[model samples]
Target: MGRAGRKTVLFDEDKPHNRVTQESHGFITQDGVKPSDFKKRARTDVQKYPSVSIKEKRVEIIEKSGGVFRIQTKEGKELYGSM
Candidate 1:
């Protein structure tokens, strides 16, 4: 989507849930990779595109109305997306 100039917003909470438990596995070529490492790589790749934006804020609510998806962040910011 980024290569095609489509807007992409990735919301990551950066929680350490995996660190407190076990290493993440089951994906092809990504086995044994730490959760933080995986996210870092993904974010780095996505950042190559100017149209893609990553937010560290958590989403508080999501609703669909008038053919658009509305997302409210914990910071009280509202964002809209169309399918």
Candidate 2:
């Protein structure tokens, strides 16, 4: 963010709380809001930035030993990550 995002960080939010209702002591403004609602709002806010790409899929394999990691996607998309 200091000088534009140079790399991507694949964040894992697999269990993004399928069912929950309200949080009252953490975030600002949205105090006592539904968890799902808060996630929706958070995702929306994050997605507003062009650099972020949200992928809703299970991470099958994550081998980080070599200089790069070869990630195999469920949809068969092989992504290489610098290690």
Candidate 3:
């Protein structure tokens, strides 16, 4: 979406992967890659876009009203967006 000039925010809770030590397969060019390494590379690629942002917050609730989305985080931050 960011590549299409749309503003996007990804919320991450920083949770550990259940199979962190195992290699991930099925992804082209990323087969056999570790989860942490894949995430690092993917984040780097996404961050290159100015309209994209990554938020290190866990979402508590998501409510939609009047075609708008309201996202509430566990840290008491609220964000609004529309599709």
Candidate 4:
């Protein structure tokens, strides 16, 4: 996503792992990689981008109206933007 181009992007902080460990499938190169390994790699790639920022907080509420969206984060941040 490009900065100041898109209307909104919300990232709900989640571990993304349903269980402690899992097996990979269908990928030819890394067929049976560990779940943690994938997570770490993905996080690293995201961190490499200058436009991507990471946040850790549950989104309490999100509402949209009149081409604008408002999000209330659990970290006590209220944000408004256009779409």
TM-score of each: 0.85, 0.58, 0.87, 0.62
Instruction: Give lDDT: candidate 3, residue 30.
Output: 86
Q: Which 10-residue window of candidate 4 scores lowest in summed lDDT? A: 1-10
Report how far residue 61 has shifted in candidate 2, in Å: 1.4
Steric clashes per prediction: 0, 1, 0, 0
User: Per-residue lDDT of 1-83 in model 3, one digit per residue for the tens?
Assistant: 99888999988888956455788788899888998888889899999999999999999999999999999999889999998
Error of 4 at 11 (Å): 3.5
User: What is candidate 4's TM-score against the reference?
Assistant: 0.62
Per-model RMSD to reference: 1.6, 3.7, 1.5, 3.6
The ten-residue window of minimal lDDT in model 3 covers 16-25
Off by over 4 Å in 4: 2-14, 25-31
lDDT of 2 at 6: 40
Which pairs of residues collide in model 3?
Answer: none
- Tally clashes: model 3: 0
- Tell me how far the alpha carbon of residue 40 in candidate 4 is from the true structure, in angstroms, after superposition: 1.2
Q: Which candidate, 2 or 4, would have the higher lDDT against the true structure?
A: 4
Candidate 2 clash total? 1
Candidate lDDT values, in order: 0.85, 0.64, 0.90, 0.67
Judging by lDDT, tell me the better candidate of 1 and 3: 3
Off by over 4 Å in 1: none
Choose 1 or 2, whichever is better by TM-score: 1
The residue-by-residue lDDT of candidate 2 on 41-61, one tens digit each, is: 777777666666677766677
The window of 10 residues in a row where model 2 has the poorest summed lDDT is: 1-10
Question: In angstroms, what RMSD does candidate 2 have relative to the true structure?
Answer: 3.7
Candidate 4 residue-wise lDDT, 1-83, digit = tens = 53544433436477565456586667566668876676677677666666666667677888998897888888889888764
